[model samples]
Target: MQVAYDYEYQLAVADYWQGRPTMEPNVWVPSLPLQMTVAVPASNTDLVVSSGGQQELKLAVMEESTEYQHERSNPMEDFEKAARAFEDDLQKMQTKMHLFPPSMKGEELSKYSEPKVVSIGPYHHGKGEAIPQMESTKYAAACHFINESGRSVEEVYGAVFAVADEARRCYDADKLRLLSDNDFKPMMFYDGCFLLQYMLFMCRDNNDEDHPIADLPWVVVDKLMKLMPKPGLDMETFVGRVKQCLQTRRHLKFDPPILDESYKPPHLLGLLRFYIVGSTDSSTTDDGSGQGLSDNAKKVSLSVSVIELAEMGIRLTADKTTAEINKMRVTRGWFTGKLFLPPVSLDDANARFLVNMAAFELCITPDFGEVDDTMSTVCAYLCLLGMVTDNDTDVQELRKKHILQGGGLTNEDALELFTGLEKHLRPGNCYYNTIVAIENYRSDRRLWIKLYRFGYRNQTAIIAVLTTIAGIAGFLGTLKSFQ
Candidate 1:
């Protein structure tokens, strides 16, 4: 409509002047403001046409309908019922912590959690490359140990097979589903004998060659190399393999033979941890036996960083000479603290073994994150190390302080090795009491150092300030005397 008005004005001017409107000075050209609009149809049945329209209207239809309610819902009531059921189920399921801790179940840490060179327990009984190679070796060790007792391999198999069901009960249920009773017996028999023989060999005199393991291929190769006139065996490969096996094997030392029939370990790794933990002095190892110490820390407290600890007069030292992993000693005095970390050589093999041992300990523990007395001390020790050494710098500091045996690992690798080791690792009641003491000691020592340094630097200024105040007082008295 606005466009039509503008067009009409232009036509009237053109007809009057006989030409288009000129843009001369003091002359005005007529125009209309442009407005765009869309036309809407009216609902009336009678159509009324207009020459000009004032505004545009859009037509729309709104339909009316009825809504019905099928049912009423109380969501809060249903949620409360579900929550109560969940609590009950959680309490019921809390009894069994699986042999493999859920934290260690991921693929990123599987190599550390699974057996590599050897699988001793039923959890990793028959899965990998290690099984085939170690199976025959285990049988040989079994034969040698059984023959010493005047029992044949057949008798040992029968004996272990008889107790297969009981052994199965010791392991968590999920791992042994694929293995049958028939499979369980042989594996246990072979593994049990191997462990027993190895324990027996370690307990024997160092020079004793009568032990059965000396008859194995690698041991044979070692012996023959010593006796033969010419270079009998290629010393490199076999020697390295033997060296690795020795290091990777769980238990290194045996004091009293760990063959007490009264206490049956769950599996081979369990047996190893049993022995390792048993070797620690009862005074040092915190079994959470009592109500707990009077000064026991109420919360988890890791030590400060290595350099910070050293500055506080706390010394870090590695127990490189100690063979047992569970043996850690902490000593404190008024002015200083000492932490004797057990020697740890992290490589692929031992890291896996340690992780599996910790997982096994976690599984057997009836309740995690409590002060349980019967937990594995090895797990406790690993947790302590994990707490103390957090990163590459910590690892390097420990190495420099002789508190870590690198085991051919760089600082970065050692850092990764200890990473996430403490996740879901709750300390037992008596666990880390000594560390807590050390932490308290360091805190006190640091405070003292700060105070001492402050006084030492400001004492001269203090004397000078006192002298100036005295001089000012004398001048005031003289002025009063003059008045």
Candidate 2:
């Protein structure tokens, strides 16, 4: 007779487990009786056994098979234990990092979130072929940045390698799991060098002959593109990418680079973010801000749009009236508010730079559909502008007032700048106070009284009323004469 060993064994185990009403002293009792039995036909062979001998053979087979099972399970048991321990440790580390993964809100937002000219860290590494135009230039830029300081590339590489572990922890596990130190260190060093050198060129008023990147034809073209705005361009391609790098270099000037050894940014992008948003002052520095999100700073009330506040007798003026263009300060009066936005040169590149930074904030800030009160000030400000400027009319108003300088973008395209970013923001409740004040002033009964008094106070109303009555009388007299 044929025997189905696996099927029979499974059936025996199922019966044992399912039929048990009480605890057994030995769970292995079922396996003790289990053994494969086979019989040769009596006509075909002389190997037929008597009942007594067959019974003896079955017992012996059971003992040997049970011992084999025990031996095989020992190592498997150890492996399972090790796997459980490893998983626990991974979970703990993940909890410690608190990193929120970057989400693809949509194709439009995703385009802004991803790096164009350069890929910084693990999240986007190897996702596509390197941009042929930039790959060679990036390596050249790295060489220049390292050699310009009379330092070897190894020195920069070593510095980055030393902190590779810390850098890896900055990203979510899924993006980073396949990344090893060998793949990561080179990318970080190269990207860092490119960014630092780019910043150096931007901060300088003139590109000297010895400027590491000045001689590059690409660099010349990049600088030219920033100064000249293209008309009829609707999407970001060559022009947009170049502008983003330039704008970032420009914005970085406000915060400046902090080169102190104590400040260890998690990665190149994190380093860029530090200069843009993190304070250099020790008193304001965020210590133990956790691995994931930045802490709460404070929230200010949202301001009214330029046109609305103007109608309310508020004078809108640029606060950075001085030569320094990087200073962003907002000043307000009871009836007059001056919004000091540094001369913002709006283009696809500037828009992309702002949006990506805001995306970074959304990813790192702790929230449940709302931005943390302590979110990055830069992001909050950008979001406020995005919230107010919803369409072409708003863009035209801001541009007309010199509040926004549209680089190459038309009014409709300019709306995409802040409006697209608004999709993934949690503007906290801090800036409502200003709006509340404006609403209260608009609803006040005293405001109408003031308007009435101003009109009648100088007998301007009496002169207007008498002039109207005389004009009507003259017209009536003329009609009677004609009749």
Candidate 3:
């Protein structure tokens, strides 16, 4: 006889039997049919059945209960998997070229942040009508680059194709989904070849008359040159030149470390940034600030401008050794203070490169595995410039000291550039250290600064008082002599 119990009721009865205390054998239930026989073992409360029908029903209930429990726990498992995928996506995004930040968007900043002459990476590849015209130039550059490399075009393209998947991940996923592998591989191959050829052409000592990019507009060439590696005679000389360029102080005897052999740059821009900022030491603290500094020290504010620094007997001087941002520092002497800054030429090309570098640093996330704040070296440098430059007078002061070489830009324009950039940049460790050093110097020589300010503000009055006192003293001396 078949039992007319629902699946839920069967499960409930199974659970009740499993939870019950030890019971006598052959426990009969009034709910069962007359032909059905139930045996309950004394050692366990599990239902034991001699009939095949009862046994099959009990096994089905056990399997369903296990499945129900698994389904109940599935939400947490799914959530955990999604979280892992999200983290992985963020990590991949860090290596890609980032778009201009919303905070930095403005007509004044557009010239600096956006690519004007040519687009090197995927972020601005084909957005403009005029941009696609450069595609022919890129193709020519690729042909020339391949010819120079002494490698077959097939081999070169194959190499790029091999890494095309990784390269594709360095862009917005949504934008990339619209592009097929066929379209993407050729873009990578062409872009890579063009950049290599351009850098090689610009970095050479003798300009070849037949170079593919020689006929480009001067404005375009100039902008591209600003981003190219500095010219060196050979590989050894190039390393030395880069090392020398990264050294912050001329006579300080401190040498900036070179990039490690194993450190592969994600792209040409990343390599350029490495050269500009120098390699970050892995020994840096988790916060990306160097060790031995307290939180309070890094939090110190710098409100003094270039003019105010000069008024307080602090002189601004060009480093003259390197243009690396990490080299800025403040030194105090017995009677005066000096702020040493890397001199920069603020032209259109240099301004564009610097602003894009700053924007790139701003896009770097903390999960990128390097010191997040350390990457903001350009931003910190700009913030320092903004802090010191408030008006044309401050810009003039910086120019006078040879710290700022304003190429084609007037004092007002330079002031405006720094003012526009400084508001969006967060100070990095270098800026924090410079400010802390200045604050420390101010604290150490508080009395001297106060006295100097007092004397400076009343210099004419003090001079008059001294002259009158001298006259009175001379008269008293004459009277004493007569007596």
Query: How high is the CA lDDT of each candidate model?
Result: 0.51, 0.45, 0.60
lDDT tens per residue, model 3, 1-483: 343321221111232334445433322221122233336544423455665646422233334576666665568889999999988877765466566788788666766665656666556766566666777777677666555555544445556655666666666778667665545555565666666565565444423121121111122222223333345213332333333432222444434345566655555455556676754443222232333444334344556776567656778888775566666767667788777887876666567767877777777653223565467678878888898888888888887888877455788878888999988776666666666666666655668888877887889999999999999999999999999
Q: Model 3: which residue pairs collide?
A: none
Candidate 1: regions farther than 4 A off:
1-98, 106-108, 139-149, 152-154, 197-264, 278-303, 319-330, 345-349, 368-376, 430-432, 442-446, 451-483
Q: All candidates: CA RMSD in angstroms?
A: 31.4, 20.3, 21.8
| 1-483: candidate 1 lDDT, tens digit per residue | 333221221211122234534433322222223343448765734344445854445445454444424455799999999999867644533222245667676544665655555566565655677555666666567556555655433344445545556556545566678665544555555566665556445433432121121111122122222332343323223222222332322244532332445653333345445544544344442333122333433443454555555555557766555545555655555655566666655655556656666776666564645634336565677676666777777888777766555456677766666656666565553355555555545443556857644555676998898899999999999999999
Model with the higher lDDT, candidate 1 or 3: 3
- Give the runs in model 2 whose Cα sits over 4 Å from its true position: 1-104, 126-130, 149-156, 206-311, 321-342, 367-374, 433-483
For residues 274-382, write the lDDT of model 2, one tens digit per residue: 4444332211111212112222322223456645544544444443432222233333344443444434566555555556545555555555235433345445556
Task: Give the higher-TM-score candidate: 1 or 2.
Answer: 1
What C-alpha root-mean-square deviation, in Å, does candidate 2 show against the real structure?
20.3
lDDT of 3 at 333: 70
- Judged by lDDT, which candidate is best? 3
